[model samples]
Target chain A: MVGSALNQIEIRRLVKAFGNRAVLKGVDLTVAEGEFLTLVGPNGAGKTTLMNVISTLTKPTGGLVRVAGYDLADGAVAVRRQIGLVSHKTLLYDDLSAEQNLRFYARMYDVPNVEARIETVLRRVGLWGRQRDPVRTYSRGMQQRLAIARAMLHDPPILLLDEPDTGLDQHAAAMLTDLLHEVGATRRTVLMTTHNLDRGLELGDRVAILAGGRIAYQAAKSELDAEQFREVYYQYVKQRV
Target chain B: MPLIMPYLRKVFAIVAKDVVAELRTREMLSSMFVFSLLVILIFNFAFDLRAENQKTLAPGVLWVAIAFAGMLGLSRSFIMEKDRGSIEGLLLTPVDRSAIYLGKMLGNVLFISVVEIVILPIFVVLFNLSARDLPLLVGVMILGTIGFAGVGTLFSAMVIHTRAREVLLPILLFPVVIPVMLSAVKLTAAILDRLPFADVQNWFSLLVAFDAIFMALSFILFDYVMEE
Candidate 1:
């Protein structure tokens, strides 16, 4: 499940270290075009770091990372145009309305037909009614929905969600699950990092466990047994801990 | 024209976004304005600014107030982005990294200039100073602000992730920005004194040179500073 020739994202021997400490040590992973990959990892297991490197937010220390066939080294700007990220942080201006926030990002991404696209995304995330209200006034769930709207506003083919459900309540998380389902329905290549085993297994076509700064285990969802995989997840995570 | 238009548009987008955000919350401008006003008020009352010494004292006091208040605005410029994690949002875009720097620097200049515009007239009244050379003084201040905001914007991004960014920004910023302030103060004093432009031509050249140097340096270095 790791290697697919000519995939949308291909990471070979990916190394990411912070000075003396290494977070991701020679990670090898790939997500084919239109495939959803859920990377499950324990706390401090470099999930966000991997997402950051892929999104061109964090530069990798070593190894080849190619996104949408563009290398991270020389083609970061090109890669940025190909991916949209939804991190735990909302990444929004609280003072700006939802519409304004989208407009700002639309201009940044050079999105075509800005107003219409903003409306389309806002409607997709069910935030069109509150488009004019300040983001600071939004609940955690609403903010996450707006974040999804933001990520999709540019219509990038690849989506990277790094623990986007981190701060949401149960009801909001469920709503997020629904939103994720809708996003998955679009057949966009998505790489989501999650600690929620149930949601992780449910959403991804393939689920991979990240432990010891590497892909410890992985399998296609059709080939996985939920109970056995839960045992395997805890085993890998506990070993790292 | 084809290549530059998109770049300029992106830069304008960032500036426009900052303006909209600031207008909505009044977070950056109001604080900067009030703080600058207070600095002038404190100096005015403390020194008993009289017409005799006001000319000499005004340059240092004015620059000090503007620099300090500008620091507040500059610190908040990236801090706002970092606080909401919107800096990453900006970085994730395909726009050139230098465009982000320029936009942020321009936004800072605009905020600082607004603070200066409001405070200058009040400063003149408070110090019992003349308004004859006000335009020239404004020109000097704008040049100083471009330099100030240029270096300040770069340093603000450098310290955005630090635990003590609010404190660290001034420590890192003031030393680098001393030349800008010095030139500005010199020109301000020269203008108010109605000194021949030939006499102070050196300072004017120095101000313009530093503005160009700072902006160019910041623009070139911003990508490195922003990279993790």
Candidate 2:
């Protein structure tokens, strides 16, 4: 039961609203560990808001959210400790060196052997040489790498990426995909939001389209062809609009 | 200790990081220091009163300068965090939201303390009077700074999303922080004139009350201000 519980994130009838405008309406989802789940949606389809809810950054207006076996509403702190997020924003201090930023976060996370861990992660992200420089001096690609480094520093069992490829070039995006695969191989569950359909399908074990604040379509990559997936997505979005 | 220890550590780490960054850049403190001195200089010239009259007016002038200068420091406190998206990074961590608020408020307190330390002596030299009640003056400064920074940090988080952040901070803050300013001025006047503590006990209580109220309010409201 513990093993099974360790491998899943469950959301049921989740609803979130800002004022009277509802963003997520009775959305439901389940993701297994080691599964690369991609949430693809058009703008304003509540993808980010749903992600925020799952990450415990935003509370839901209604419904159940459980991540890594912890209930979001009741065990939010525990749930948060098990999840890591990378978003379009770098979320690093420009004045601090990359290493300092990582060390700061590592201390915040209370990760043991912080110095060794920061060195290893910076090297993994190909940022070791520039780790001493302030983040403001870093290129967009470098900052994204540092952001990824920060997210993975605590070694959470789950990862959430919100358009992680937004500012990256093909080379960087390819590296990110490889990193995602490596993380997934370690039996960590991954939920990502992306606009890049090809990249999403290529990396995801299961691809989901969020529309009208709900999951309009979801299936394993092997179950659907690219053309069919695109057609389904287009129709779903069109009908919702 | 329980898990809150880690969150507290994170808060202190953030505070330390801000201090180190400010030390290197000297951006926030220098601006606050220079602006405060300039305000005092302006007050000296504007009043142009004799020493007998200056004693009575000094407390009001000193606090006004501190208030305006403190606002400058408070507004800049979160600019780097918002600019580099560090707040989002912070939210991603497993720490409690109130920890972030406390850390940022403490950082503001330290910065304001630095400004006050420098300005206090300068104030004495300019006004040609000794601050005989230094301990009470410091106490009032701490209470006033805490109350101001607590609310200022929260408002800064709110206005970072707005178009006119600089203008919005004072507009939103000044009305709300009236109690803090009133208590500070009253306490300062009492101390400056060497009044008995019993006579000024109400002012001290008011200052403590304002600090507690605003601190709690800011801690609770911070999560809302941090939301995307």
Candidate 3:
């Protein structure tokens, strides 16, 4: 739904293993340049592993992954420039203030106009006032908000979020939902993994289920309502059992 | 020139982050400094460090304090990163792996050097030893620290994800850094004795060589070691 013809993420027969155990069996998927794709799977479905591979945090055991038109192996740095990741962990230094953390990453990314960009992102996340406070002093929701600011600091075109709403309260979750809606409105390519099927369906323009290390079902929001998607999701789970 | 500037900026960013964090918390520095102070204190009380046998034993005592304290600092450097999952934040950046290693290694060097600088005068005063060659004694300390931090940084990264990282770091580090330790202890003794530069030139060269070799090897291997 709401996508260009260009594919932002291209995976073909992707396989990831840890020593003797295989986490991600051969899988294929493609996300369009402006699509918000929500990926849902049961625990141990390798959603995080898949996200790690796409982010270049974990190397794939086999097959191929191309992000933003660059192969992961051939051009990981280039790919890194195009993508931002918000994992379950904040990936932030708790000892650092939000501003300092953002500044550090800005310098690492070689972002131009660093100070101004930091202010804009902080303000966008409603964290401009508390930017000077150490991250550890913030609530879980505040930290997660700061994390989103950090990820978007460089204004990357693609975002990868893995369970960002985990450990959040209802109020914080609603705040995150508003922020994610704003993020979705910007037309950036997004791939989010979640256990909350309703949230996933609500936020994503398209929803896909990953079962047994592969994409088991996929449909656009226009084609599948929450009831229909739940039926499909449980069908896949039943099949797995 | 243009290419290297950005790369250097990235390296400096990491160093600045570590410095600011350390300054704010002082966890690693305070522990390392107190641990070194304790080592010197225990040794001072335990041994009669009169000038007679002091020349023979002082070098060992000084290097031992520095080495053990440096190990503590090194283990902490990465453990902090791993504990908070910030290492993943670092690895997710576009910077080269070598930049991360160099940044961390330099931070380790800075911390250990600060401890050494403070403790050296205490060491001299407490042991009642005359360090006439103060400058050269410091040079040896810095050189030996470079080598130690180089290898120690790599090993720290390796053991960071392990359950018993604190115990494992010393085990893995002590053996590899033997050359640096020996060369430093010998050169420190020779300098304190006011030996001619020619007399201890070989040891100095060995220390220099070890520093270079350790830094180069760790730099080359960091990329592979960092892979998840």
Candidate 4:
């Protein structure tokens, strides 16, 4: 199983420390190819830090991280080519239209057939009609949707999302949920972190909770429903604190 | 040629995006143009001019204007990216990190050159200078701006995340480029005085050397600085 086709991400004893304070302490986790793993963690649990590490946006203080069969330290550019990250920031230029923004990233990633891909992704996000409008004019939901389209431009097989559904209303949240499910169904490996436990359990094939910079509790999602997972999460975090 | 073409395209892509953004606002260029005129106007009024001494002081005045105005453009190059939250997105691209440095450096150089081009005629009119060596003066100005833009681009990236970056960037940048500034001022003086090219060759070579050294160091060290 170590080098099997199913293995997309493997982390062993990951540690990230800023000065004397350690934020992620010897965290170990693995996500199989085409599996959707949702990580639920309390505030300050280092979830974002771990996502940054996997995307190679942040380097680790120590330990091993390998994504898409390449080591993190020596293979950053290679790793970047294989993953797309959606963080809190939309990462879109406010002045550039959605089409221009996608075109810019498509060129950066050297994505072939750039125009067609931009159109397809814009259509998928339900923003094709407004492609020429500056992203500044976009509503929060529309901008978030454009952000997702930007990530999908390069079409990397590994997707890392950090709190992607943080600020959406119910209608937009439902749209995002549908999009996430479609993305997961397309045989891509996904690792997501969220505070919404109900959505996390519903979407994840496996659920992992991080506390005190470590994996506090992890199990198959089918083994615990939303109510049981809440009890487990609170009790586990309370004991650790 | 084919192998290097893609990298060149990426470099130009970044510059194009920046150019498009700047055109939409015209903020950086307008500020630099206005500030350049203000500096020369202030110096023109403040100084008691002897026509003979004006030739002597012309180089210092020209470079001082260019350097100060160019610093504003350079700081805005990366600061705008950081402010709009696009720097991280730029960083995650698959190309070498040095490509981003080169692209920003090129954008900074382009903005400086544009402002300097506009300011040159104003400079000549205000200082009452003749056109004996205008071509040579433009040549030296280009060289001087390259070194200025290179060092400024490096430091602007370093200070992008810091507080009061407006105050911090100049403080960090001014001391480091003193050599380039001195060489540039000397070259400008030599050209304005219409001294034989041989007299200023040393300064010209030194400016080129400074530019080359700074560009190499900035490109080599930027990858390490960008990685967090």
Each model's DockQ?
A: 0.89, 0.68, 0.87, 0.79
- Higher-TM-score candidate of 3 and 4: 3
TM-score of 4: 0.97
TM-scores for chain A over all candidates: 0.97, 0.95, 0.97, 0.97
C-alpha TM-score for every candidate: 0.97, 0.94, 0.97, 0.97
Clashes of each: 0, 0, 0, 1
Q: Between candidates 1 and 2, which one is better according to lDDT?
A: 1
User: i-RMS, every candidate?
Assistant: 0.8, 1.6, 0.7, 1.0
**Cα error of candidate 1 at position A207, Å:** 0.7
Where is model 2 chain B poorest over a 10-residue stretch in terms of lDDT? B1-10
Which ranges of candidate 2 are over 4 A from the true structure? A1-7, B1-7, B158-163, B224-228
CAPRI tier for the interface of model 2: medium
What is the per-residue lDDT of model 3 for residues B1-228, given as tens digits with 9 covering 90 to 100?
226878888888888999999998998888988999999899888988776888888899999999989988998888889999898889999888888998898889999998998999999898777767688888899899999999999999999778999999999999999999999999988987888889888988999999998899999999888886
DockQ of 1: 0.89
Q: What's the distance in Å from true for residue B165, model 3?
A: 1.2
lDDT of 4 by residue, A1-241 (tens): 1234567999989999978999999999999999999999888899999998998878999999989988888888888889888877888999899999999999999999999999999999999999999999998889888888988889999988899888888888889888898898887899999999998888889999999989988999879888999999998888767
Model 1 lDDT tens row, B1-228: 227999999999999999999999897888998999999989888886667899889899999999999999988999878987898999998978999998999999999999999999998888777888788888998899999999999999999878999999999999988888888998888888888999889988988998998889988899999987
Q: lDDT for every model?
A: 0.91, 0.86, 0.91, 0.89
On residues A95-152, what C-alpha lDDT tens digit does candidate 2 reach at each position? 8899888888888888999999999889888899898898889878788888889989
